[model samples]
Target: MGVQRLKGKIKLISVFIVCLIITVFPVVTHAMRGDCGYEGGISSGEAPNKSSFEYQEVCFITGEPIVFKGTLKIKKTYKNNIINTTYIYNLDNAEKKATLTRTLNYRTEITEKDNGQITEKTYFQKDPYEVIKIDNVTYTLKNYDFTRSSFIDQKPSINFYSGDIWNKKTYQTGGVNSGRSTVTVEATGNFYGYDQYWGSAETQIINYVISSESVKNGKIDKWTGTAKVTLSLTTTKQLKYEENLPEQSSYKGVYMEKQYNESILEYSCKLPEFDSKGVSTDIIKTKSGSLKIETFPQSQPLSVPDISHLRGHWAENDIRILYSLEIFKGDSSIFNPEQYISRAEFVSAIVEAAKEVPKDPAFEKKNTRTAAARKKKEEEVISPFIDVSTKSEYFASINAAYDRGIVSGDGGRFRPNEPITLADALVILVRSVGLEGMAPGKYPVTTFRDNDLIPYYARQAAFVAQEIGLVKGDTRGYLNPNEKLTKARAAALINNFINYMREGIKKVYTEGIVNYN
Candidate 1:
């Protein structure tokens, strides 16, 4: 019995050893696989027992032609105690240059440490690579096309001034001097294809039209001027505000999708002419400069004002006159005043204002000052003659006034709606009926005793108003002749003249010289 028991114990020991080998064998194999195996030429005895991983490099240019071929390794794990291990080697034979570079990383993990639950994952990424072709031509990662070629071919700027272009009307008292000049330049090359490169130009041109005789020492005795410029893609190209450039290219090709620059320039000036009393006066002022304008198309949020009373009050008069003349036709039924007013619209408004105060018959019919008044009014329409070309809508009005002798212009210039002064109006009014011979003492001269402000040339003619009873002096007997004439004042002055003419007709009727209707 003792011999049989010892034999049983030995058998049990053998079984325990066999179980231990089965449980530990896989763990050892897996641990070996986790380590990196060094590779080198070696004898069979030194060679690694397990398969080793191999790596090689592949490269490509961004926008060139080339080919790439490579091998990818893959390994499969066993599951459910089955010997299901598999290995794969992937290779591609397709011929194509790489537009981008990519990097791949792989990882395998035993998620459940208690069990042999092997999981493998892969990741991919790309990076830029420089390439040199077999022809020894180097290419970068980014490429450009024909559209970019056009912009890149342009050269840097070279600025120069252009001569003035003069526009004239008549020779006598109808000429206006215009100093219209320009600046020309070429755009810089390499402006295209740059991911973040942008270009812009800001320019201004100022002008002064002075009396030929007034130029003594580079200074004009009396002068007037105005300025304007072509704007953006409509005229210029490659526009940017006084702001920083963005990272990516915000522009496309020049033809259809490319953006152009904005050019902003302005000018203003006055004229030298006579007042109602025939006094020479200088009237011109200006604020001329340039700006960089940008355009953005986005819906603007509506703003609710705290106070609504001021809504229509701001542009009331301008709106009324503009609407009456059909100058302010709203777009989509909404008036957007912040929008830039066009030159056509501005000129239209001036024509409307002139129409509002048409030449009166009382001023036109009288033989005394009719010819002179007609001449002066005609002159006003013809000054700065550039304003009225045959194609211009203002041509008819300008020519009509010229024919009626309602105005007279400078040498050949017709300054339309440049802003009129009190003296300018008087010059037109005085010539209407030939008031040259009227005496200063006939009317109430006491009313306008203080006529010192009247320019020497116009004093005598101004006194004629007193002589003709057209004006009774204010309490101070003074006339502010030099003050700028307001719209209301101009109207009042016209009414007064009309009344004067009517009184003269009444006197004639009382004497029975003229028959009453």
Candidate 2:
């Protein structure tokens, strides 16, 4: 009777164990399925919620193309066995999106060669979808479920532990006009693995094998065996943001953060190799490739520097105007209006005015000068004066004036600190206005009583200076060309030059006539 009770107890225990297995299997299977979609159990439903609308625009103003071409040769060695795989990809036809603030449109072509067969595929982006059209059949792909599909997808989920499995899916439309065509992907990977190809602790390495298939109308369109993929992630040094406003210098310490993903896909059969291309068909086209994200500061009203001695002076307005334009920086806020200006100071002021001020009112819209053009001009001019060192502040300006034949040195000595005479000032002013060669070989005669006092070399320059209203004699009508140029007179002369250039005055001088309008 005891033996019979033992057998019955064993049967009851077996029945209970069977019931537990039946009940818990489905629950475990469902939990595993939930974790299969993404690297960190991230589901496809979670993607749209994480999509960012706060995009920074990058415009290519010149419409220059961005080209990417590479050939990936992957070799895997285990014991005495070696496997080699080659993947060739080319991305081109990338141009500025005219309608979008910071967008690019491009096409990508990928080729895989293995087992003596070559397979080629091309992809492009249409609004809200990635389309691959081949032989009059369009395969539209939507809802990319993977973080890293290709280079076009800037973000990819690479943070996963060893022995993790994930699944991805993309919905397809067009081609065959049947039920939904779906591409299903299953990947198993070991993240945090070490590989020599990637090197160092600076990179995150992932080794994975993925299987993918496309089903159309309940039939398989294509399928693939396990494809080995080795991927590495390296965070590069941040790139600086360039601003379009010329006056606002770039903030050197600020940079945009970027992550670079390098991956190699090795497969012997057809497998889906694309995520979303990040190409937006709805783009804003602009004539400028540069993106303007912030409001730029406008030029404020000119501030007149205080010069106490110039109060109620005859040349006060001229001094204020030149100072407002930043052409004349008075020493210690004292203009010293009666002090004579040196030759070096005069040339430096002329160069600064030419670069900072616009040639005409119409040109004022372009407020910034071209830095590249200025540097090029500086490089083209070599200093011929022994007194001017390359490190001198006025070296470039003096060299530039000399290159244009506007100013010449005396016996190879610049005499930069020497006071400039009225005759020499006239020559420099006339040449600055594009009238260097317009002077006649001989002037008929001047009514000034002091014409004989003017040197022979400055005769024509003196005549042109008077004709252009750039200079005027004293009340006695005596042209004192030999007198040293004072700070106030220099300011007035430069102000007149500014007016001449801004007014767009054109001058035509015949044998004996001067016509200007």
Candidate 3:
């Protein structure tokens, strides 16, 4: 009897356990299925969004082809590793009731290579790709029910401009003198224009903060700041054209702040905007003009020791040569004889003088006949780097200066409106003249002790100039090359070069006359 009772209890327990396993296994399976699909588990039932846009991305190296990439996104709360996945759709025009699915189809080719042999393969990801397309638009998955998407582009553009504003009066007071400017940018491109095979474009808001401001005269001249902005995934309607879009978009542009650099005058800041992931980053576009963030007064004070009373002492011939070369245009046609010269203008003059010597890299890509035709139309001259289309006028002199290599640009960025310095001018002049044979003479006399400041390569040129009376000492007996070159000093220096050249010609002529006689 005891054995029988034990057997019955065992049988009953086995049946109960089997029933429990049957009930719990299906529930768990259903939950797992709900995690990743369009089954409307805990997420909305919808597809991802799409758009079509183009960007010119500069490569890390110079002269490299620009790399172009596209992005798309889906809006669903579902997430599955095997099949379909969902994403949060917070765009401005998204429908709360619907979900989004997305996929990326790069029209790429595949190449197959075997050892000692190579085979070329060509494949184009056609529009409306059936394999990649899920319910609306998505990359394929094993289960296919997940709402969270496998692919999306989470970046958008935010750029703009504000006009120039200056506080010139405040500069003299030793306060932070600055100028102000701003830029406003609206979304210009969208990814949805591409075929339906790809998912809609999307972005995730990370941080939208101010980037930087403009600078003037080497100071924090002007800057910008951004107001807080909200992210919008989709537009209220389609953005068929740039003009059709309103000035105000759901995603506001990033802000900017300015800082001053005393060495620079005209300053520009790259625009700030959202990256592919909707994070704030500097927006730089070659097509769109760079952001001019600030303008500041960049004048430095003259030291008491370097101030000299000597002013006007140059000949007409020298000035003419320099002027024709666009090197030295005299300070006030009257030629002031007793004025303190600034160091900045001096550098510019010397650079201009060097430009008189011809250099190539000009006329490289020009249609010479056409350029000459417009010579009088304000389009004849411009810096090699400046735009010839709209800013042809101001760039005339700059263009001439750049070609001679008298003045070089800063990291490919040129500050056209900045002032020049005396030392800066001397360096450019020394380099531009190619003073290979012009070594200093062994004359046992010296005036300026700081003549040693000239670099060894430049020493030969400086010494020769001194020997030939091209560079004269100031009243205080100092060669203030580091000082800002004033217009007056520029005139004087140019005159000196002309004299040097003429005296040599005279010497040669006299020797010839003697030999003939």
Candidate 4:
């Protein structure tokens, strides 16, 4: 009987050990999975594990005052040709108090770029009563309203692990009251372990400054400020299993709180002050104080091309304007201002600009006829160029120019890729302005030193272009008609053309028509 009892006890011990292993195996595996190791590789739905606990919390605090400055200028040209200009300047010299409460909702989208960099876009919303104050003025900026959506990019921080430190720079710019302001923020981030009260948490300490200037009419304003901010996030929470609770209800929990204190170290504002006599005066206001902010989790989020190497070029502004209008797109952001432009490119730009021109009834009728002919099945519409295919991207623009008499291809070939000469460009410009037959048959023999070199067929167009200040002679007084036109010259000429169309010769010829003194 004693032997049988001892054997039974051993059997029970074995069973107890087996049951313990079964119960603890999964929990140990889960805990180990949360350890992403020292290496930065993370599996999907892993690492940054916010689901290790029930509730997550986030908080933000500001350390210093936010300084801001702005300027605004407005200019208006009336139909009667009257030009009016106004300038207003504003400088805020006060302790800035602001608090932002954000809940890290989720990673809505992740984009992996060709450069192997991953961009994680997270959506967040601010809590109510986010206060912004500048001295005595409490700005009710709508951007702080709880109903807006806000987002932040987490690319550089995506690979960060516990105890890691990272630095980031951010820039934000926006239009404000006829002016614009730019804010630059520099931040350092400290990563904490996952599964904390705020899972997948990080603390960011930041320093930010703002500078803004604006112009409208004849008024101008300038503003500037500096401040510090602290941002923290606890992205997600893991719910404890409970028999009676709904799964969805358990997973939808988030908490946030924030506090801010800003001391205005230095503050000043320069603005335009008017006296009773309506005379302009400059006024400066300076003050300092302590600003406090309280914040909660936001329910609504608030959310708010570079040209190459054309610096200091004479036609840079013109090129930029044309680019903004989509009339000119240089090869890969390169204006290549000094490079000669091809006939195809020149014609394309001209046609694009013409699209914005006020439609003339006569031109409208011509365009209508052109469109009709293009649609008819029986009308075997012939292309003017044997080289240009209907499938070519520039075909429509070239065809439109041909129909409008803005350009006439040579022979049966458009020679679309050939470098266009100065004389040819002038002829196209002259014809584009509806002055095809208005040029004089004869001009002063001394108008250009190289007059004899001018092609007889292009003399009238050259004369018209020169008379309208659309073309200029070289320093040696030569027309250089046979020379290939450069992109810079083309941009300048196109700018002059647009100006003539808008303001006419009388207003645009402020410094006289001829380049010669």
Q: Which candidate has the top score in TM-score? A: 2
Q: Which sections of candidate 3 miss by over 4 Å?
A: 1-394, 413-418, 440-447, 455-460, 475-477, 505-517
- Report how far off residue 325 is in candidate 2 (Å): 0.6
Off by over 4 Å in 4: 1-305, 330-332, 356-381, 442-446, 506-517
Which should have the higher TM-score, number 2 or number 4? 2
lDDT of 3 by residue, 1-517 (tens): 0001111111111111111111111110000111111111111112112211111111110111112122223321211211122322211112212222233222212222332111211122322211222123222222211112111111111111111111000101112343442222111111111001001111111111222333334444222232211111111111011121567754222112111211001111233343454333445422211111111312222111111233334433334334434444444345443344433344445444332311111112323344444343222222333222214333435444444434444433344444544444444444444442455443223356777654443455456556557676678777765565555566666656544433332332233322332
Root-mean-square deviation (CA) per prediction: 44.9, 31.9, 36.7, 31.6
Candidate 4 structure quality by residue, lDDT tens digits, 288-396: 3322212122232111014546767788767765665567865526557888898888899888654422211111221223444444242223455777765566766
Rate residue 415 of model 1 by lDDT: 55
**Runs off by more than 4 Å, candidate 2:** 1-300, 330-332, 354-382, 442-444, 504-517
Residue-pair clashes per prediction, in order, are 55, 12, 85, 43
Q: Which is the winner by lDDT between candidate 3 and candidate 4?
A: 4
> What Cα-based lDDT does every candidate model obtain?
0.30, 0.40, 0.29, 0.42
> How well does each candidate superpose onto the true structure, as a TM-score?
0.24, 0.37, 0.27, 0.36
List, residue by residue over 233-317, the lDDT tens digit for candidate 1. 1111121222225547442111111233222222233434444643335653333332333323112122121222225644433
**Quick one: best lDDT, which candidate?**
4
Question: Ranking under TM-score, best-scoring first?
Answer: 2, 4, 3, 1
- Report the CA-based lDDT of candidate 3 relative to the real structure: 0.29
Of candidate 4, the 10-residue stretch with the lowest lDDT total is 1-10
lDDT for position 357 in model 2: 14
Q: Positional deviation of 56 in candidate 3, in angstroms?
A: 69
